[model samples]
Target: MNKWPVFCLALSAFLVPTAGAAGQDVQAGQILYDKWCAGCHGFDGAGDGYAADYMLPRPRDFTLGIYQIRTTSNGSLPTDEDLVHVIDKGMPGTAMPGWEAKFSSSQINDVAAYIKTFSPFFEREGAPDPLEFGRQPRREGIAEGREFFEQIECFKCHGDAGRGDGPSAPTLQDDLDFPIRAADLTENWNFNGGGSVEDIYRRLRTGMDGSPMPSFSDLIDAQFMTEEQLWHVAQYVHSLSPEEGPTISDVIVARRFEGDLPASPNDSLWNQAEAFYIPMVGQIIADERWFAPSVDGLWVSAAHNDEQLALLIVWHDPSESPDPKWLEWQQSVAASMFPLLDSVGVTPLPDRLTVQFPTSIPTGRDRPYFLMGDARNPVYLWQWSSQGDVVPEATATGLGNVQPRRGESRTLASSAVWHQGEWRLQFGRSLATPDSEAELQFATGELIPIAFYAWDGSNGEQGSQRAVSSWYGIHLEQPTPPSVYLSPVIAMALTVGLGLLVVWRAQRREEG
Candidate 1:
């Protein structure tokens, strides 16, 4: 037999059921399952509900019996209590509705019992071996236990060393990205609901809703584990230290940029300048005629290698002039040297400012490049390099002409022209009403999207009768280096320790 499998089987024999599991109610549980859950989870416990296909993550396929999320020991079955809890709490942002008030406590308990019947591994026995079953007790002699932490996906978010600083930390923001913190497995105290082994098991079994965690109940249904596997994985996760901190690289500083536009006449010549500001504002727009005057615009800040910045402008004029003013305004504005404003988070490095309105331009090294207007209009071309030299104008994508309805919105697409090192791009949008909004991706290339916000009127401004008046800019670039944390370290240590033990044991056997 494989030494690893033998060791696991030997270590878990102790989890065999006591008299408590031999008694009452497997059939009673079945009756309840048919009444309450058969509609979605199927009579056979396979997730094949009429509505299951429509769900994004897909409904639980209990027939496979592999639970994706739970607080129980890895490979071991979830306790009866674990099943009961999820039915009551209800999953957030999903079709799973809570049964806390809908079903009585007894009904919920019955349903929990019924769920276990679908998975052959679901045991109503004594808890698995805490060392081999619960969290691999961070015991001194159990070398393989530590190694098990990394084999599973524990270190992906929770740092390798049991800290919570995994590589995906920055993207897990508070607002846009669910403020998810990989469990600091080593800290013990930071455990969300509770620090006990069962508590952790529950999280794994049910999977936290609204977060990346997924329920693992179906994993058990798949016959992936025979009781022993579940217990071992859970024990490994539990053994990790929870108090791990982040390394310097994991530290991040959020920043913004600003600038001002020079005053211009209200004529068709200002179309370039006015078009440049379309993405800046949410409402209002320049009439169709180019060169027809009056434009509303503002200046925005400059950026460093790893920062994100954007400008928003909203125009509401509907009058059509034979001589368009928006295009002219866009050209005049993008050509200005002072277009790049102050720093939003980092200090501005000294570099020449090249303004290119509508033409596509070549970017030099990695310093920074600017995406001016729409690619079609070749109004102005410019570049800013570290040596403080203004490179002559190049082909540029001029500003786009966007005329949305009273409650409509439109987006402008432009290339992230390469500058010094990384590429840069810009987008313009016009919102005709307060409730109007638009989202545009700079390009579908290898880029990290940055979220931006801007407002033209009061907090609750209403353009009920007026055109949409709001705009947003999405910044794209490769993600910056990530900060290090302890979770990964602990997980790595555990995995390496297990592998070494396996090798060492083999050598000892040969010597014997």
Candidate 2:
């Protein structure tokens, strides 16, 4: 054998250490649980409290043990480190406060051990304790997963790979130009707290709420993979981080811009869309659905993009300041949508984006469907009623200020740009066509009128002042990926292989 080959193999083995940590004792854990944790998390770890019912997203029910801040794979308990991180940094946007100052490291460890006692799954059976994440030390699977993120076209929304600077991120904001960026995994401190192995695992499994992160448990069938795999992926994503910049960058600077609109703009459709579009409807509709205050006339002043969102819709919420509780809950639910999609390798943008609005709330027993669209001009509003009846006329509402269109995709504005280190984006009429504007406009001039609208980041905080280069629609029917065709085959093969391996090991044990 070549000595060089042998040395290379040995070197690689040295670089990647196998998980060898032992499990902690649950007996000692019970004491800590009783002393410190049982108050918020009941004796049985069921999330119940006088305050629990009022909390928007509710508290973590440890007995159920479905931790949302985990890095473990689907259907696995969080590791010790996961618990420690949560204890250190309190969860944000919630009642969970960082406890690093309140508890000692040893106390935190005891709590983690105690938390594991609540669920049979956390008993570990024979799994690792500290539960290492990633394959190689220092930085595990960072480069590979980074490539995967881009290979799967995650950059289209999550921008700049791990940095969360995707092209479409700006348009995903709500009434406010809140730029939702991709999760910076390297930052062990999360808004929901917890940086330990299990915490990360839970996040990977359940996903963050009110954001676009989705859950992946369904694809994994909840138990397809070993807990170790989940840990590895979490560690891998976590490792893909950018080097730290000055702490000053942590300060979020507010940007506001102003722009002018054209004369024959699509104000009518815009008004109707607003009048009917529910950003946060009741449970009967979507949780984040909301109805616009009025359809009169308003103009887009600015736009922005922060992290992973691409469709920022920052219209004035004169109708009502969104229920803060509802908004918080929505963020947690929404955060999980994209992550879940990522886990299953689903492309963020599906084939076609569809805009659906109710023509009328529903009359007697008839539900009216409205087909809204943009007129021939990139800036004009158009609509069509879909009750299988007569179409309506082009209505004009002098409330919008979209730039005139000559045909083709209209370029919007860009608010902030991060290059090397400098963060800058123009705040004026820079809307011009960029790549990816194929078949952009829609035409339906006569109906109840509910058109879909999204803002490009070129403008800043308000709607864009620049003439839009073009507008894109949301994917109405996301198709199953071709890999879906191979799901049965893959599942069967893995199942059979695992069964055989188990049988072989059992037989060997018996012979011994």
Candidate 3:
């Protein structure tokens, strides 16, 4: 008789308290849920609240007894602790907000108990035991893990480089028949469950319920792979993301270089320049507000010589828009976000990026409106679209007011590449343009205001429906003076001379 099953049963009993537990009051939970959750989850817990239509992934229908985040086995009820954890920390990459600061532990517990009452399955089956997760073994390198990754066909949804642009990525839908996107493995910070290796291991073992992610526990049971081998896969997945999320900065400094700027985005010279991470949010202050935006943020690197300036912008995008493969994805996103509108004639628009600057540099803290500009103060723009290699120069006084500048003033040159779910673009221009009034002149030692707007056309973004960033600054770094480098050598020489003089003086005094 194996004692492991008995041990697990014993542990499960201790992990979850009974429904009739002392701290859990269903009536008290109802009051809290009605006050806090009713707006999105509905009074009947059917996920049809007023705000439900406006959100993607929608709200959880508690009556269905299905959850995406869980510690238990797939197709089983999430443990009470799982519910409490979600309620306290909330789900990332969704509309859910953490309630740890707002609700007491007991209050959260009461709500969790109350949520179970919506489904009859909970009453009949009770809470399920969490899966046994063994200790992680010593890493055997990502090579073996990469092999396992391919064997399991993770690339079918997560892509070869884990940017979520795989062949099946555009077609994925949740169990509820709502369009869904696969996780971008390179951005673990946005993982709904958590980003740690242990969290990844658990997700692999138990799988995410109410989603296409399925458990691999059967592989272990069938002796195809051992528990230790699965941990390697988790470690490999964990290695895909950065050690920490990118930090936001107020300014991007352009490094001074000796020669011409990097010829293309792939130039190794660009690596010498530090990359700045800029976060973006949907344009919501004006009409036709965008609630969901595909492009979340971008990485920027800048460099300049005496005559010219260059910028390399890198961002993750699942698809190169206008690609026939993503046509269905474009339609699905449009229909889901705007069900009342007709999407029959809709065609995929090209992806675009715009670099924004005030037509005239701001003299003070005051600047034009972030959404393009106001009539009184127009803004200059370097607009790059996927449809063409040319980067057109434009000016805008407001959201809809844009004038493209043609002929001699259009000196902006650009190169772009989309590979493995990422876009790398390099834009080059002269430091000083012929038409200073209509264009931005890059100068050293000055803080030039900068902003960005991105359009992921596959997500139905166009016109005012795009991702935008608040005003930031770019400073062209001044060249290092030769005197500053010589100062260190001068100090060392003086120190040695002073020590020699002191030794001589001491020897002369001893001789006397």
Candidate 4:
């Protein structure tokens, strides 16, 4: 029997509306909302729609008139323009999708106008003008900005390096008591409103409503900080993120080096290697499916000498696995996602990562199954866990069928470090091994298939419940031959000689 109807009804009752809304006669907007928004925001705009329970930081209850992206001060209504802006741009890092391409300007305005009718607050207290945000000042340096960041205690929630692993991050909840994670300030591209300096300044002044963030207007009124000083804080936050997000590439190129490979992730030699970004998604193809994955992506860099190969993997994580401080956070997430299941007395587990390769290089397009291979074609694996220093080599016929390759096959070595809110791991191995039957041998200029699997133990990710990636290729670049360089020099010398001979012949002909 289909249980969707029963499940939605029970969930809707659990999430009762906080306020009542009157019927509005905006026929056009009502038609659009029913078709696009009702599935998540509910028919009455109470945010009890069928899909609400499955989402974290659940859908916004429009009847309350509380919004997160706004230019107005806290506890105030947003302008009509603000509403239209959110509708057009949508909320990033969430399920909401931008409708600018799908809807016309008039349609968007009509929808924004209709949304206001859901809450009586718009009638009772009208939206005030947006706050004044002056232009950026020519400050001496980011030194003052850094000072302001510490003075305001931004580190209490955003962490020392703005990676969002502060002590208070684990206990934060939204206005509706749903668990919420602090923004990882280092990733400005994920910011809901925008990532520009002006955008950061506006968010700082107004703050995000219906969330733990608070407005700083009182500080200005009380002489705690001048407006320009607040701008410095914005500048400091803006500096945390890179100029642009990393670009995705289909292949990772391993550069050949003359000297030994980098011994650790922090080695300066790694600076010369190119980093490749790979995006990850929750592994939902198998049983015990995971819909939420803490690790979003990874940055990989590879280098090889004649005898050895080294790979550096970097990723951001809010907490070191099994940390006592984040234990409550683990329980809170479990309770929110699976309220009926008993999550008490559950302990955090170690973080894990698996690097997969085919047991033998494929001569054609045919390769082993992506899910750790099938019975017919097995896979070779280098598995690492945060609990130990050794990286074990293994073979797997399929998921949950991994077997550690003891004896001479266990040749993988690794080093790892977790600081602030980031983890850096380096894996090193020989280019060729005696156990070629079970191990993949590296060759220059060959496109080797590779894939990745990661488990964030703090987020209850393990075994099949983890983040995964599809197949990608890695190529070991061959060193340039000496003859190639000599050819270019020889061509230049020949050209010069030919030009001199032609000039001498022309002079001789004129003299005769």
Please report the candidate that would top lDDT against the real structure.
3
Order the candidates by lDDT, highest first — what do you get? 3, 4, 1, 2
The list of candidate 3 runs beyond 4 A from truth reads 1-22, 389-391, 481-512
Question: TM-scores, in order shown?
Answer: 0.31, 0.32, 0.88, 0.86
Global Cα lDDT for candidate 3? 0.83
Model 1 TM-score, 2 decimals: 0.31
lDDT, model 1? 0.37
Full-model lDDT, candidate 2: 0.36
lDDT of 2 by residue, 1-512 (tens): 66999899989766632222344444555666676656666677876644343233445677665654555544455556766777677685355767789777766665677676566775544223432333333435545545544554556655553434455443444212233444444345433545554555556556553445555444345665444444555565655432431121101111111232211222222232211111211111112221111111112211212211112222221112112322332343333322243232111211111122222222222212111223322222321111112111122222232222233433432233224111222222222224223212211111111233322112111121111111111111113344653344333233223322332344356425
lDDT of 4 by residue, 135-175 (tens): 88877346787998888888888899988888898888898
What lDDT tens digits, residue by residue, belong to model 1 across residues 85-119? 66786644234667898877876776676676666
**Each candidate's lDDT (Cα)?**
0.37, 0.36, 0.83, 0.80
Q: Which number leads on TM-score? A: 3
Worst 10 residues of 3 by lDDT: 494-503
Backbone steric clashes in candidate 4, count: 0
The digit string of per-residue lDDT tens for model 3 on 22-86 reads: 56877678889998998889999998777787677789999999987888888999888999999
Q: For model 4, what is the error of residue 377's alpha carbon versus the real structure, in angstroms, after optimal superposition? A: 3.1
Ranking by TM-score: 3, 4, 2, 1
Model 4 lDDT at residue 157: 85
